[model samples]
Target: MKAVLKRCLLGLATFSLVAAASGAGAADPFPQKPITLIVPWAAGGSTDILARVLSEHLTRSLGQPVIVDNKPGASGNIGSAMVARARPDGYTLLVGSMSTHAMNPALMPNMPFRGVEDFTPLGLLAYVTNTMVVNPSVPAHNVKELIAYARANPGKLAYASAGPGSTNHLSAVLFEKMAGVQMLHVPYKGGAPAVVDTVAGQTQLLFSAGTQTLPHVRANKLRLLAVTEAKRSPLLPNVPTVAETVPGYELSVWYGAFGPVGMPPALVTRLNLEINRIMSLPDVKEKMNAIGVETATSTPQQFAAILHRDADRYGKLIRDLGIKGE
Candidate 1:
């Protein structure tokens, strides 16, 4: 009887140790491991650039490595779907843009995930200064001149876009529709390559964010005609808006942080606060602004609201314009 009791006590002690370890792990703070920040685009582009910058700050602030993972394909649906399917443990996050979240669902057929339902919007990161630019060799000074030139050239003027349903493509299409001109559409795999072709004069015009086009503009390789925002950007108040020349044409692109749906509310708030703080840093804002990116900060709710509104707006636009994926 005594021997049997001894064995029982020994087993009890072992079980207690295992239970204690399990409890400790469960009680540990959030982000006990490195976090993944998926960019959903190729490196060296605006979204990738912004993700890397935010990841550096996040790594320092979160006490864990916020690694950036780029999964570029199908107009950003690949990386975004990966994040949507990820566990909502705060370790996996996404730096999603308006194109991926607001526009792609409407633009792409066989979409992998619903942008609004599959994820939790964490915070607004920045607003890209969407611009319409022409290769320096193009005979156009401003929006009016560019419109006139495009009208005169018609199908002779080729405009490079990131892809068939990319924001750049949509912007250029809207420009053609509103201005009553027909420019040949040259779709590239991504914005960087499209901008490259435009700068090389292979394509005479490009509708892309300022981050990619403005540097070339400054170098005289490209000429900035106007922004795509509803109003002028504070960063470049002198630059006219496309609406001024082509009435009712506006496309505002923004980026936001997101995690898989069903993330803990506490974790969502914590991350939202961190992102807001990071974007509000003086140097971060200044650096982004230099390239025509305006850093924006907001609550998770506000981000979600913006996401819903843009999704609806762009969805209608795509349908009305009969945009299709490649």
Candidate 2:
């Protein structure tokens, strides 16, 4: 009887130890599997390229493969909505842009998710250098000349945008309002298509990212007038800025990472730290510079502030311009 009683106690003790050990082992690290970074744009565009580059670096740093899933549509709404609705487990993330996060909520009346409220802001990744370029046949060499011609042509000249409410569209709209010109607006499904059309003369002008336009410019297919940043890009130092020609006109296109709202604060901190570290690397900077993007990094708080400020600023702009989503 004593031996039987002792065996029963030992079995209970063994069971408890095994349970505790199992629980401890189950408390694995944050990223136990691969991560998916959603790029809310078509593959082969500037956003896609940047996301791919960042994913490669992240895979190396995070010990798991970071895959880019392209979900391009509705000027980035489709993919963004997916991220907004994803589980806040940090595995499903977004590589978003200023257009998707800041401008779309204001432009689209029926957005599926609230831009600021539905996502956890990670950090700013980089700024895409936008440039004003025209088909060589348009015969404009600089921003001033282009504006003068646009003013003269009125509704005759046409400019292509990635889509309605894209930064490309807003940039041109701001240019028109500031310069007092009225060129026609053409919307395309994506930046690559828009730039291709511009190069093929389907559109007369394009305010596009340097990644899509630089190759054409180098090939003498599209003529670069001025960069859209407040200052000249080191990539094209000799080229002036649109702000240089039109004072107080600045539109910056930025990219950042995001996860669904309610993501663990610890996870967000980990991602921000890792991403900032990646951005600070020399090779990352060089690669970004080569693609006409300047790498940038910020704390999660700072990135949240940027989203709020830009949403307010661009919301007013969209309302005043009467822009709508398609």
Candidate 3:
């Protein structure tokens, strides 16, 4: 009996030692190597710019280099899927947007990864308002005028979008449905061409990010109509929100970071903390403001909730509108 008791005690001590050693190893300072952040969009787009800014800050905070890889295609599906399928280690990250993380899953028929289930939410990086702008030659000066002109012209009035199933396209479609107008949609390879065409008078209107359109607006190439948000954009203080004229109209695009599902909770927490801290820095805030992106920092739980809510919203809209994938 004495020998058996001694053996049992020895086993328990050995098990405890092993557990302690494992815990220590697990908690060792993470991000010992460089991290790769994937931006599922073309270079120079809002998502890419925001990802680059974040990569710079994270490099400083984590004491390791951070690289941005732009993999733009399928309205942000290809790159997003890559991240969704990557290993759950903290090294691989995704810079997700409304199109990649929320709307595409709702609109596309064969989305490989579940927006809410296939990844771990890190935190919101930034949010920006989409602006409604018209070519200088257009007669419309505001939302009301634009609506009237579109109704009068019907199919004659055409608008441009970044691509089919893009947020830019969805925003204009929702406006048409709600405002009871039937303007034409012309999809371009991306926003740069669409905005250029709008400025060149090839297209009449567009709903695009403030950062991208602000320069053209300032150049007097396009006239401001109304922002696609509940509140007026800070960059364009004098401009009114579309809701101000077409009641209840609200839309905005936000960016965030995520990792493959089942990432260690401790790792998630550490990442969320570091990124959120960087987002709130004064320099970061100033740079984002100069580019028309509003700072939005949140806990991982809060970001996850936002993803769920936005996914449901876009899913219903896509179903009702019968939007299909390209």
Q: How many residue pairs clash per model? A: 0, 0, 0
Please tell me which predicted candidate would have the highest TM-score against the true structure.
3
Per-candidate RMSD vs. true structure?
A: 3.8, 3.1, 3.1
lDDT of each: 0.90, 0.90, 0.88
lDDT, candidate 3, equals 0.88
lDDT of each residue in 74-105, candidate 2, tens digit only:
77889999999999999999999888889999
Model 3 — TM-score against the truth? 0.89
**lDDT of residue 276 for candidate 1:** 94
Candidate 3 lDDT over residue span 172-255, tens digit each: 988998899998999998778999999999999999998888888888888988898778777678899999888988777889
CA deviation > 4 Å runs, candidate 2: 1-27, 137-139, 200-202
- Alpha-carbon shift of residue 43 in model 1 (angstroms): 2.8
Off by over 4 Å in 1: 1-28, 151-156
Native-vs-model 2 lDDT?
Answer: 0.90
Predicted candidate 1 versus true structure: per-residue lDDT over 52-100, tens digit per residue: 8899999999899999998998778999999999999998899998888
